[model samples]
Target: MENNQDSRQRFAALVREHSHSMFRAARAILDCDADAEDAVGEAVLLAWQAFPNLKNQQAARCWLLKITVNCAYGQRRGQRRVVYMDDLSQAAGSAPSPEPSGLWDAVLRLPEDQRLAVMLYYYEDLPVAEIAKTLGVPQGTVKSRLSRGRERLKALLREEEAYGF
Candidate 1:
């Protein structure tokens, strides 16, 4: 049996390693930095409570991300309304590019399921199996969503280019 200190240290190391991924997952769902931060905070607290019960240390990243995503969904549901005060580009803590990229815009326009799958697969660099486990979907479903999201992004980018926007 693991001692309490060892458990705590292991949990802390896992959280520290995956914190950025957790925030990105939350951000993907919530679309608001503050709300995403709140979701991540809530996920950490919840995960801490559940850590002792976790069976696989290797699966910790997916487990934490799944918690973050659920918390983000719950946060979205609790909000009566969503207000966008900052430009989406500014949310990443960087100055807007002189030529703003439409790729991210197209991604935002993707259907929620496709968007989540794409973000988890590409942005988070998660494998399809892990994404499926994180999102509680089948691997085939995640693959299909990624395929569709790519096609949609290609069409959207083509349209943007043709319009000279």
Candidate 2:
């Protein structure tokens, strides 16, 4: 019983530590804040259920994030809607900044696979191997996605500059 209690405590602490990352990963996949929150909650529950099966405690972060990404994908599949990015920003509880950066806008415009790879690798500061684990893709695939995402972002920025928006 004590062992189970210890495991539960450890899991809760880890969840707290990585909650923001989990939310960000979910938000990257889902269209709205409510969906993202739901995904994260579901992921946490799923992770708890499978926590005992997890072998490498050192890889907990990647493992939790992998669960989160999967949950977010599931949520997105269930709800198909056209939601504006501005609405998402507002729902996240932050007023629109006077100077909105186009880099993030371009990142959001990338293909889903590339966007997730970029967000996990760059924004989350996860190593390529860890990103591969989190994304369930091979390291080479993650590298390729990052490469393509960067190229796409460059083109998007250039277009934005040309249009003077």
Candidate 3:
């Protein structure tokens, strides 16, 4: 019982430390904020169950994110598309149009592999090798994905600008 308590405490600490990044990574994949939160919660539960098998403390971030990505993908499966209705007051009011945060919408339009790689490497600031391990791909593949993602993002953003978006 004491050992279990210790494990729980350790897991809690790790979650507190890394949960934000995990949520962001999940959000990048899943799009909706609510789904991102759910994915992180599910990942924490799974991580708690498998914490004993985690050999390296240093690898906790990667491990937790791996679980988050898996859970996000699982959650995405069989989920129907949902369109949210905007508030009538906000919609009807002459509110100033918010400027787009550069390249974010374009990033969202990227293919899954490239999107994940770009999010992990650039947004999460994780090293390519670690990202490769997390994604179960080679370092070369991670690099290629990053390259392709960047190229695609540039093209998309330029097209948006040219069309006056």
- Model 1 segments more than 4 A misplaced: 86-105, 163-165
Ranking by TM-score: 1, 3, 2
Q: Write the per-residue lDDT of candidate 2 for residues 5-67, one digit (tens) a residue.
A: 899999999999999999889888876678899999999999999999988988899999999
Model 2 regions lying over 4 Å from their true place:
80-102, 160-165
Worst 10 residues of 3 by lDDT: 82-91
lDDT of 1 by residue, 1-165 (tens): 989999899989999999998987887777767888999999999999999899988788889999998999898899886556556557868785543347766777778888889888887899999999888889999999999999998988888798776
Give each model a TM-score.
Answer: 0.80, 0.79, 0.79
In order of listing, the candidates' clash counts read 0, 0, 0
How well is each residue in 50-136 modelled by candidate 3, as lDDT tens digits? 999898999999999999998998898847875544444456785755445467667777898898899898888999999998888
> Lowest lDDT 10-mer window, candidate 1?
96-105
Inter-residue clash pairs, candidate 2: none
> On a 0 to 100 scale, what is the lDDT of residue 105 in model 3?
68
